[model samples]
Target chain A: MSLRLVRIDDRLIHGQVVAGWLRALGARRIVIVDDATARDEFLRDVLTLAAPSDVPVEVLNIADGAIRCIELAASPEPVFVLARSPRTVLGLRQAGVPIEVVDLGGMGSGPGRKRLHKTISISPDELAELRELERLGTRVEIQIVADDRPIPFRSLDSTH
Target chain B: MGFGQAALIALGYYLANSPWLFGLAYYTLFRPLVAGLLVGLILGHPAEGTLIGAAINVPYLGFISAGGSYPSDVAFAGWVGTTIALAGGLNPAAAIAVAIPLGLLGTLVFYGRMSVSAVFAHWADDRAEKADINGVAFMNVVPGQILLFVISFVPVFLLALNGPGFVKDAIDRLPLWFSDGLVIAGGILPAIGIALTMRFIFRGSAIPYFFIGFILFTFSGGSMSLVVIAAIGVALAYLHLTFTGGLAPKSTEAAAEIATAPVLMTSDETAPAGRHLTRGDVLRSWITWSFFSHANYNYERLQGTGFAHAMTPIIRKLYTTPDEIRAALKRHLVFFNTEPNFGNVIHGAVIALEEQRANGAPIDDDAINSVKSGLMGPISGIGDTLSQSTIAPILLALGIGIAGGTATGSSIPNFAPGSTGNVLGPIIYVALVSVIIVGIGYVAWMQGYLRGRAFVTDLLRSGTIDRVLTGAGVLGNLVLGALAAKVVTLYLAPTVSIYGAQLNIQASVLDPIFPGVLALGLVLITFWLLRRVSPLWILAGMLTFSIIAAFPFFGPGPQNPNDYSYQACTSSLLHKYAPCGVPPAPSAAPQASPSPAASTAP
Candidate 1:
């Protein structure tokens, strides 16, 4: 019936989200929106196996995911939406998925990426996408677990 | 106390934090319980050291390090905290207060090590490019371990050398109320660890079982031990499983349906049977992974360099030419991180692909890399939940219970001095964890190698893992509830004046309704607060609350007038505020005997 959370984590469906967030948010289902994962059959199977038997997981590309999110909003079940990158979340929002707030769970360090918070790294491109999402009226917050204090994206030192 | 002992403990700490000995150090020696026993042995006061260590370990029972985020450094708390407590002759409660700040400071050391070791990962990448296999392996262990040793040893050594005298002086200068507050804060701090773990494992349908464990222990009037409670819990879990369709034939039918469902086939299905890797090759690779998986753990590539090091044996066995070897090494040198034990399946499947590729299969670089990346996240999800949240915590609860003397019988007021628990506690814990890690790691690795990619689907379709997790949930909640009752200490120091007679709120009001009701309430409130606030804030609040509550009228005092002595009161913070009429002779022997009766004071 409602989307409980929309999150961005590089390591999707890992311990924190499954054990910590799902129960904390009371979401019964998971819908991972990512183009690469949606196209990869092996990844899909692994993810499905990774989830608890009771909670169903749906992997969809951005275009299909946007449509699915609208339908999920109409349903009675609570859903938790996950994506790997800010770009994916931006695409979903632009495609008309009514996202008001975005929770950044994790983004590991890699090439061309600068540290944004604890264990969260963002590239210039991803930073621009997050900025664009914020401009569209979505509040962005960085929180690793449900219990941790959520740090506003805007509050972080962005001069670097 | 001496230079030799200090240096020896520092060396022990270095080895415990190092990646050698198949990573067993992190599981065993790194625990404060064991660290206490080890430090105790070195200091010739093994029992006293262990008691202090066990007390400090109580707050870290829920410790979990996932995705390279460590909430607190237990190793620092265990090694350095235990040493200081022993040398300063501080009791367990005050020692916990000291240990906590050190644990927070130790996080700086952890982050520093993680960030700086990234340079070694970059160094390994260069060696892989040059086909320098030895160089790559060297970079993984040599430089990273040197950094770890320096960071781990020097600080611990310095702290052990000078920390005790400094802490003793500080405590000597503290006002009576403030010292009492530190003890009160120590009693309340364990609630945060329990609450944090509750966030992860406590959920709908399993919530009631926690209260069941708590009530069972509390109402038993200290007659029930943890082992007895655990037995009842296991039986209850079995019954719950049977009635909840966990053992029903319909679930098996559903599992069968999933097994027969149409599933996509990967490259393993069309294997062109070229060169096959021997069992020895896979075993060697797994051993390498088990021992050195986090040897070069860093921010840039988390476990990338370690992954390449693990694959060297397989790559060597499969590839002969320099170009082939270089390509194979470089293929696995990309970003990868997962739960090392349960994530061994990825390693096994990749080994199969590499073996097939060497024999002339059509598998490309993308196929192998995709398998690693795709499976890492999902495997880590299940693995971290099972290993970190479920297995480790359950085992730790038992170990802590035993070491703190709460498991044998509930008569002990959790970690009371002069009641140093049996040393067998740490030994049993180490043995059990070693068996599980080695056994599970070997089986998961071999299963993945033998069944290839299909193993994951088969493992999930069997329905056994679900049952195990379900059973673990019930058991984990029960033990945690029992642990909360046994470990969390919250005694109300305030008294209410009713009808011209003073009434102790803790005894007359709370205990008559339910024993440890305040402790239970504190844990639940903390659990609720964890949802909206960080643990650090909760800790700060508890400390401030305790300190402010330690005013002359509000603070706790000795329960019995006879049990109080000025020397005993001054030495042990528990009885410091007891109203002794007159100071005893200076030579009055200290009453170091057990004061279990003090908890029931009027």
Candidate 2:
């Protein structure tokens, strides 16, 4: 029933995460959920190697991941499930995946996104997804980098 | 990769897909597999087509770069080489030898496509300001891809399907003069590329060190490897920093800037700016704190260290003031760029310097400029070592592995597990990308927000970053050494078994220091001939040398220059797959010559 921290990073297994994040979290597994990821065999193999071998990684798609939420409830291993978009989380919740919280990570700022923090930003669609996650009982937060604290997404929702 | 094949592919692709766009000879689209398959299916060897196609893709693994620069034209080469290898009754090596010109034809294709791609970029440009993001993105990605496919698909198909045994007949009848001319010309063309590389990185503080690394490693004689040269590199990098690094006053400017910025991060901040991580910050962005992933982030507008400044929100929320952010930014500032490798902070640090100024960080104008000033030397060093010294050689090594030892494919002495080898293939990319992305990411985040004046001052206290580079250099040297022995220049060609004719090739202008020191003589000759010589001259020299060597007047070996061909010598397994505009390749392996490269451990 525990997911260490929910992050949305495209490059799931990289040096910064392995050397910096893993060191900070004292985590055991990195769970990735992305529909596109499932289709890229080479990417999957490469990502698996990027992360720490000692700390296992399970790259799953949103549907399969949500269905396997029961596995999370069954197993005690601390995990971090990374999704590409907030909607994926909403889909997970609707699919019966029980998640307690979600933290925002690096999202490359582009159209539809209003800058929330220097490293943090979001779009209207994303804001709605956050609201959807919160409605599903998952606390939504606005955190982009590792050296920061939790700020409720709702606090800045109106201005942004 | 002969000239005819490239022309055929370009013509075919354009005609087949878009008559408006000549896909002929464009490297990205030059699909040798399609060509080979088309040829084999027609020439009684679908298996051969598939075999050649698979083989041609090898050198391509490491083929990508920031720019579209590539060395092979697998499309034509694949079609023709496979066809020739099959119908000409030649082995793969000979087929490859015959295909070199075809691959070379793609070079012209590149020049042509660059001009066309510029139009597409301009087209994308018009859409970008209009806020047509997807349109712009598509323009950037799709046009080039479509163009490539067209150019590759048609020409390869036509040449393979229609081109005849002319090349084979040429092999038999093309007089020694023409044949010898090709061999000579082919050997010299690379000088143009080398000169381009050298011109960019030949100067600055790190130049002498490059020489030291080059000479010492080359001098050591045993399988000169990166491990060896990198040892000297470690010493060179460390000494350069220790003796000359801290002297710059930019640190003070950086300190002032750090003192100005604030680390007022939001709660969800999880960027990796290495300022002291607060417990709350750790708890909040725990997922990233333990790094379990990666991202290919491009702050298109945030050039330089603006990326580092992007972490401003996180830093501000995590810390009370700019001190922590400053510290983090200072640690990240360096003359880093990913052309050589990623994870380099030089660009990020410079961006931070810019942001500090923009945010009124009070860095002395002169002090602020130091970051930029400090970059040229380091950048130059990295460019030369990574791109010219290491990378070029590795390309050649991969070329050797894929092309195999025999000039003739059938005569290949060894395929020597390249990509599948622990180092030559995918691992090279993984190692390179991991190093690059994390390095760049950290620098970007730091420059974004973590830096302040005090923070900048303390971070560069001469002990921390210096120690890191020195230690890393040492480790790099060790690792590069093992790689040199095992991965880079480890191949040994079968020595010439000559009769009792006194060839006199080994003249000791300065008496042979070691027994049969002809290898040393050869190295000196190549160096002298190459030293400050223009590439054209170098080409001329090589042609002259190859011609002299190929003269039946001189020897019985296949003397025709056109005799050497290749399908995709560059597409060997020794390269990494592309993650960005370029594929991931660690520093290149030095060129394999009878003379050692500078891979002798320091």
Candidate 3:
């Protein structure tokens, strides 16, 4: 219950999440679960700096993130989780993290990525991973901000 | 209403959206408060225009349009909605009711413009392929601006020319209950804006500052102006920073780590002395970026075309062969977007990398592109929070406070007709915003060039940005609290039948406890609801609640029944429903008045 929000946004620890979501959800901690970011020392420093100094930030690989998230879920302090892609979330879920809802906040358009919703573009591999996440009994919704309506991932036409 | 006036207003709209003003117009003229003044001046009612614009701007106080997605198009609302209001002779509150819907419709126009501008990005891509630098620049500014002019001007011109007549006719025919509902909606709508701002700045530890501001304003019995409150806020912010040790440097370890990090160079790569770029070339590049970063903003590539256009001076200076020029242009022309002011650091670093590459360094396209894509997100995160969330909102709240006569030393008065409190509000806002934006943009740009790729790391680790953000958060919360007290108008209309005596909740109970407890409560409730409900729904709910509550013995009477401007507004629009010309009897209940429309209906 302490895991307040699990979001997939490529631009992790950015303005929308910090200024908009963190306060909205009253989450005190941010857990960035991305292998690439966890491996890169400079990116870790940059992301740590990007967040407010009061809130603690943890940049962990998938395996470590899953363990940390489980511990956080059992704790009283609220935690906000952010990942770069669906694959990361899928990794966490397979690692036995009880995730009930997955919010697709932002995934920028790039090479080989197809538009799925407003400002959210994902590759075929990502789309499949999201479908897998849904099949694993997690609700996937696309919501950019707290004020926006959450659109279910299943409702969007995935043909393109 | 004249063709000439309408055309002038439309041209102003075009210029606001266009890239010709070095991005100053977007921050100034595009705001409804300023746009209203401009439109009113065109139509010979500058004071009324400023008031209406300020009213329309109330609900957009926390507005933030990040990454090409706008919640509402206030610019469109400013120009078209103000024109319609002025032409129709609607009061400030009613004008807000009309302006809110117009702002929603403007999002469609924004998306349309963004979608179509993608074609121009493709055109620029072709020009880059052929190494046609002029073609690339032309595509960035010319076609995109033309499309903007057409989209922004044509609709505004037509709307301005004909909308007032239609609105006047429609108002003349509107039913009494609906017109009453519009006024009530206007009074209630400002909460949404305040709540939206609270979503961002109202966080842990900063929460107390909000209450401090609210208590100061509410308990001061209307004696303290927003300026006084803001002064107190600044002092408190400084004290808070001092006690929290936020001003102390805590990132020396990170800075040292970055300082000593080894540069990754291939073992076989030779270090060649590259042709050094003059500071003037970098300055020119930065100037182009500051002015035209979003000149050809499109959905496909976002700021990609604008990026290539900015790099033209850099490319022209660094490359000689056609292939080299083509490669440089094509690389910069990929998808890019960030907050234009603080995001300049990325551009500066890219320029340094380009210079190094042209000098035969081992860097390739992937290295430069990775740097851009990687830093853009984090930089934009900090940049947007600082500029959009903190700086813009605080300044805007100050401007709004001054314009609405709540921040000045004078007593807060109802917005009387043709009474512009201070003309200096908008001017001060524009001047301050321009200086900050241009100053920060230039400094960040130059620092990026001078410091190269390590600049962002250094800037973050120095703890200066954190201190600024922390201070801004404190100031922002305090000001927003004061602003909510000043702007959000909510009165509990229903009186409780206590011991067979009428007890007005707002006057008898609430005011004794806290002067604006109702308004503060409404803002907090709306802020809480924003987490679970969409803003559009909250807007609809408020509109519905206002209408139903305005019924007899239900909601409070007209917001400012005794105010002269409210009389002027009601008399002009609701003359057929009730006698607005004659003042209401002081002892009689507002609902006790006989309605001419009700009598004639049967």
TM-score of each: 0.89, 0.40, 0.88
For candidate 3, what is the TM-score? Answer: 0.88
DockQ of every candidate:
0.50, 0.01, 0.47
**Model 1 TM:** 0.89
Per-residue accuracy of model 1 over B431-531 as CA lDDT, tens digit each: 87889977878988888887777777778666677777778778878878887887777765334579986566766777778887888999999998877
How many steric overlaps are in each model, in order?
Answer: 3, 121, 1
Give native contacts recovered, as a fraction, per prediction.
Answer: 0.54, 0.00, 0.44
Clashes of 2: 121
Instruction: List the pairs of residues colliding in candidate 3.
Output: B493-B556
Per-residue C-alpha lDDT of model 3 across residues B414-525, encoded as one tens digit per residue:
2323234455556667777789888888988888877765777777777898788778778888988877777666655345578997666665787678877877899999
Rank order (by TM-score, best first): 1, 3, 2
Q: Kindly provide the TM-score of model 2 when superposed on the true structure, using C-alpha atoms.
A: 0.40
The residue-by-residue lDDT of candidate 2 on B64-85, one tens digit each, is 2221223454455655565655
Cα lDDT listed for each candidate: 0.77, 0.40, 0.75
Candidate 2 reaches a DockQ of 0.01
Model 2: how many Å of interface RMSD? Answer: 19.5
Evaluate model 3 with DockQ and give the value. 0.47
